[model samples]
Target: MSAKKRERPPVPEILPAPVVDSHTHLDACGAETAADVAVLLDRAESAGVTRVVTVADDIESAKWVVDASTWDSRVFAAVAVHPTRTKDFDDAQRSGVERLARAERVVAVGETGLDYYWDYSPPDAQQDAFRWHIDLAKRVGKPLMIHDRDAHEDVLRILEEEGAPDDVVFHCFSGDAEMARRCVDAGYVLSFAGTVTFKNASTLRESARFVPRGQFLVETDAPFLTPHPFRGAPNEPYCTAYTVRNLADLREEPVEMIANAVRETAERVFRLPTVTRG
Candidate 1:
């Protein structure tokens, strides 16, 4: 005899709502097709990630990022030479970045800066490339996005010596309280990412506590550092919610306050107009 199948209990949704992913790499996300971007964006939007700033590490990637930004209003662009790719900054490279900076979608000049941890490029070369990007940011009147890894001293020194533009963003900030204090005092926006959610990310959390509202932001740096619950999995813009949550908890603020601060900081530094909230 066939018995009626019993209905399963409905499971409640557990994922957080969307927030802005201030830094990511859409082109480098390894998405295979237009449908891929569509799927990614859908997940992000559903998770509360309303916007993303896709960073380009080289001229070619920068062009792709800019093009993608044009096609998707929710995405923006940041162009630069990563410390690991300092050798790529030749004449043509410089010209390409300059042209892209003038593009309507190019909002900042980075994920550029020092990376002593990798040392893929000589320290001198990294410094030179960083200086070049900083100069270009000033020339183009755009904010400077930085990537410092085990090279905080050099990064801070260079920025100070070069008179870095007023709009400076220390993306994926992992420095300690002192560096955070210094950066905040210097008017630099500290952009926390998934690393802030790691069990051993006390230093980063402390730094986040020191950064005040209107002077802090958050990012996913997708395809990397997928936060705590999702660690070891591929990260996406939607995962920025974990970072925002961790930051809010660390700063003793409400989740909405954290989101508002991050949104404000991004708009101020990138010169983006106020976002339309739903």
Candidate 2:
């Protein structure tokens, strides 16, 4: 059987405390309609994931994200052009993204940073776009969600040069303990994804533990980075439970404690309503 179509994982036990998925791409997870969003949110709430921040990677995606946010009160939106797509970013797209950033439902300016791993975009263009996005983030008074990949040094240098937004988050942080500490020291939030659950990610697990409780966040980054035991299968927001559990075990804290901490952090970072759903 093809791994991409691997057997769907059974829902894990419900969490004792509700949590938030700080970052997820519902559009990429095949949620194109209200029905699809309903099914995904139902499974997520069943697993105790009460709210989610869905992000867009391009102009059209920004539209999808805003529309999805309107489809359900549980969903919020983050809009920006991904670094890889910034190579073709034009004046029109820039203005459009700025407009979306001001949308009442939009809560963040990001998924923007440099990606040296993929040559899809030139470095210079990526840097230019990164600076512009950084400015937009500060101007909008929203947290900046960064997508750093194989360009940590450059990302940090650029952020330092451009002056980071008041709220900066390293989404799906893949840095070592040292980098994690630096981020925490700078008051930046470190969001962990399912990769922290991989057996081979000892450094990542160590870094996850090193991050302070209030600075920690859990995410699915879904339809990708499926946690171990379901590593090769596509992921959904409900699967954030597995990553949160793994993080709790790593930090040597009770699952509820860690889940609640992350839930609170996500709410503060994204300005989400901390609701206790029935």
Top candidate, metric TM-score: 2
Tens digits of per-residue lDDT, candidate 2, 1-278, equal: 59656766778888989999889999998999999998999999899988889999999999999999999988999999999999899999999999999988788998899999999999999999999999999998999999999998999899999999989989999999999988998899999999999999999999998788889899999988989879888889999999999998998999999988998898888777766545
What TM-score quantifies how close candidate 1 is to the native fold? 0.91
Which tens-of-lDDT digit does each residue in 188-262 have in candidate 1?
A: 888888888888888777777877898888898987877876666767887777778778888788887777778
Index of the highest-lDDT prediction = 2
- For every model shown, what is its TM-score relative to the native structure? 0.91, 0.97
Count of backbone collisions within predicted model 1: 7
| Candidate 2 lDDT score at position 54 | 95
Whole-model Cα lDDT of every candidate shown, in order: 0.81, 0.91
- Candidate 1 clashing pairs, residues 3+ apart or interchain: 17-47, 17-48, 18-47, 18-48, 18-49, 19-48, 19-49
> What C-alpha lDDT, on a 0 to 100 scale, does residue 110 get in candidate 2?
82
